[model samples]
Target: MHEKKYLILYSTQEGQTYKIAQYMAQELGESHCNLINLHEAHTVDFGLYHTLIIGASIRYGRFNKKLYRFIDRHLAQLNAADAYFYSVNLTARKEGKDTPEGSVYIQTFLKKSPWKPKKIGVFAGALLYPRYSWFDRMMIQLIMRMTKGETDTSKEVEYTNWEKVTQFTKSIEKSL
Candidate 1:
């Protein structure tokens, strides 16, 4: 079999998205993948990769601005490749289908961009209260209370389901 080329590109605020990208890349294997942070990736030659996975974390109900810009800059190349997008947010773990806000996020991006990824995954994000500032921590705590999510500020909390992430990655692999 010929070697496969995959690119896992991601942007992270507090590292959750980065971790997920790393996990996906590791599962995909070193030889087949090139995992890069959006900030570090200046010029991406999309033609060099057969598959591309882009991931970004949501903060205050919006995907990372840098990731969006990066995608916008390379929209044509992305659309030409086998591409997938994963949005990491706390709302994914909530007990409903895509919330109005989440739906808006996806729709807004789709409307603004030329690229329509082959697959879109929304994974639950983490609440790293310990890493937040006092004001942010309190605000997030209040948001958590309103959302009925964990509000514990004493420790870090991860809402990501690794098994689901694994399954999602495998699905991408199968598609490729």
Candidate 2:
């Protein structure tokens, strides 16, 4: 295969999506990859990249509105290339919910999105009490309580599976 150029664009609310994108870039070798915040990356020409990976975190039953707008704007370019999309949500932390089919948020987004990526991933997200604002912290705590999750405000839990992340990257690499 010829040398490939990749773009890893992410929209992060609490930073998990950005961290995932960073790791993907590292695994892909930074030399041929560019990492950009989706909100600020609208001006970049997507046609120039041979591979595109978009990562976004879901909150309040929705993927970031900014990311939706970006996808809408670049639907054709994204569909034209080898595009992959990953969604980070705490719901994926539960057993049997890590895959795209099992993730309700992923399913919802897929139904709503105009651009369907060739690859889809669903990863667990983080709960950083300190990082959240007062209202967010309270709301999240309530959610955790309702969901029978960790509600200790002082604790930080990251449910992401690093091994799964590695596997996903390898799958992308195989295609390239």
Candidate 3:
């Protein structure tokens, strides 16, 4: 039996989305999935893969512009494949905001995008205050505070649900 090839591509700001893509690729098996950073990929032949899992992190309430451009350019190829899209953001860490339908950023992106994937995921991102610049830290801190999230600038807090990620991957495997 031939296993379908899969691409796990990510556009990350603080590395959470990249880490999620890498972990999903590892769990799904290295032979079945190829993990790539969207920025460095430069060129991707969508026809090479049977399934596409695209992930992007939200920075200042917006996804990477390159992500939007890629989707626009390869919408047909991506739609032909069994495509999945996941959004990573601190906003998903809030109560009642964990699902794709519940996430403001995800809803906004999906409404604007022409490519609608087979499955959508919303993952809670991390708060790496130590890695942020002063301006970003302050901005993020204010946002978090408003959302009732962790506000401490000295500690890094991870809010991702790995079990949920594993389940999502298992579902993707089943799709093949």
Top lDDT prediction, candidate number = 2
Candidate 3 off by > 4 Å = none
Q: How far is candidate 3 from the true structure (C-alpha RMSD, Å)?
A: 1.1
Each prediction's RMSD to truth: 2.1, 1.2, 1.1
lDDT of 3 by residue, 1-176 (tens): 66779899999998999889988988888888898888777788887888899999999989989998888888788878889989899878776788888999988998989989899888898999999999999999999889788889998999998887888888888987
lDDT of 2: 0.89
What is the C-alpha lDDT profile of model 2 across 1-176, one tens digit per residue?
66789999999998998998888888889898999999898597877788999999988778889988998888888878899999998878897788988988878888889989898988998999998999999999998898889999999999999888989998998997
lDDT per residue for candidate 1 within 1-176, as digits (tens), equals 76899999988988999999989988899778998998889999888888999988878877777877887888888878899998888877864534334555676777876678898877888889989999989998998899898888987889888888998899999997
Residue 4 CA displacement from its true place in model 2, Å: 1.7
The Cα RMSD in angstroms, rounded to one decimal, for candidate 1 relative to the true structure is 2.1
User: lDDT values of the candidates?
Assistant: 0.84, 0.89, 0.88
Q: What would the TM-score be for candidate 2 when compared with the true structure?
A: 0.96
- Order candidates by TM-score, high to low: 2, 3, 1
Cand. 3 TM to true fold: 0.95
Per-residue error (Å), model 2, residue 136: 0.3
Clash-forming residue pairs, model 2: none
